[model samples]
Target: MNKIYILLGTNLGDRFQQLNLARKQLETHVGAIIEASSIYETAAWGVEDQPAFLNQVVLVTSELQPLACLNLTQHIEQELGRIRFKKWGERVIDIDLLYFNQEIIDLPSLQIPHPYIAERRFTLEPLVEIAPGYIHPVYKKNNVYLLDKCTDDLPVKKISDDEPYRH
Candidate 1:
């Protein structure tokens, strides 16, 4: 099984429910989830005019390859009502593949060890909560170090302290 880190974010139409539904879809299509971070609420990144987002990071073990994982994530997003109206536009669900077993992959369609992981507090905060020691493939830094060095300045506040989901 390949270990993957996935970031979930939603800003529209019952944000929490969107996250729950996305988790269910991921479990069915991607793989079993081994760990998950508590939910965090943050101001919109990139586009600032939209509603705040609820975000979380989940660690999953899957048999799918990188490209296949990316495809499944996009499929889940669409099935959950995502429409690409604009770059960084508001969405009902956004599933980002952050890392695929510490591998560095550079394809025209996907980039692993997500390019923005270090720069976004919303991503880093939840990541640190679950995988502080998981080193980044390119940056060679642990999530906690990345979170400390992050300069995004955007406040990423944990909205829930629930235990990591396991099944």
Candidate 2:
């Protein structure tokens, strides 16, 4: 089995339900979910005019290879009502493959370690919550360190566990 980190974000529709449905589909298609970070609410990244986004990171153990993981994630996004009308546009759900067993891959279709890991507060905040000491393969710095050094000034507030979907 391979351990992979995935980021789930949603800003359209019932955000909580979208996340819950995405998680269920991911577990069914990707693998068993081992760890998940608390949900976070943050201003829209890249495009600021859209609704605030709810984001979370999950660690899963999967038998699928890296590319297969990417394909399934995209499929899940589409099934959940994602339409790629514009870059960084609002979506019902977004699933991103962040890390795949600490391996670095640079294919046109995918890039492991997610090229933007260190640059986005939304990604780093949840990463620090779940895997603070996990090292970035290319940056050689742990998640906590990357989060501290992250220059993205966006505020990432962790949602209270009082939510119905706290997973």
Candidate 3:
């Protein structure tokens, strides 16, 4: 099984419910979830005028290749009511393939070790929680190290006692 790390976020309409549904969809289309980070409440990135987002990082062990995983993630996003409008626009659900094992890929449509992984606090915070020691192939740094150096000042608060959507 290939280890994949996925970052999930939602800012529109029942954010927690959206996240839960996304997780369920991931399990169905991707692979069994090995681990999941706590849900984090954070300010919007890129498009700052919208509502804050609830975000989390999930680790999955799958047999699918990177491109196949990407396609599946897009399908799940669309199924969850995502409509593309702007770069980083608010949506019902957004799922990004953050990393796939230690593969370093750069293609027209996909980039593993996600190009922006080091820049966003929301991604790093949850990523660190689950995979603190996992090293970035390009940066040669661990998630904890990257999180420490991250300049984005977005506040990420973990929500306790909250459950993700089941279906």
Judging by TM-score against the true structure, name the best candidate: 1
Number of the top-ranking candidate, with lDDT as the measure: 1
Candidate with more favorable, higher TM-score: 1 or 2: 1
Residue pairs clashing, model 2: none
Off by over 4 Å in 2: 162-167
lDDT of 3 by residue, 1-167 (tens): 99999999999999978988998899999998878888999999888999999999989889999999999999999998999999998899999999899999999999998999999999999899889999999999999999999999978888842653222
Residue range with the least summed lDDT across 10 consecutive positions in model 3: 158-167
Cα error, candidate 3, residue 105 (Å): 0.6
- In the range 58-112, model 2's lDDT, one tens digit per residue, is 9999999999999999999999999998888899999999999989999999999
How do all the candidates rank in terms of TM-score, highest first? Answer: 1, 2, 3
Task: Give the root-mean-square deviation of each candidate in angstroms.
Answer: 0.9, 1.6, 2.1
| lDDT (tens digit, per residue) of candidate 1 on 14-105 | 99999999999999999999989999999998998999999999999999999999999999999999999998889999999999997999
Evaluation by lDDT, superior candidate among 2 and 3: 2
Instruction: Report RMSD for candidate 3.
Output: 2.1
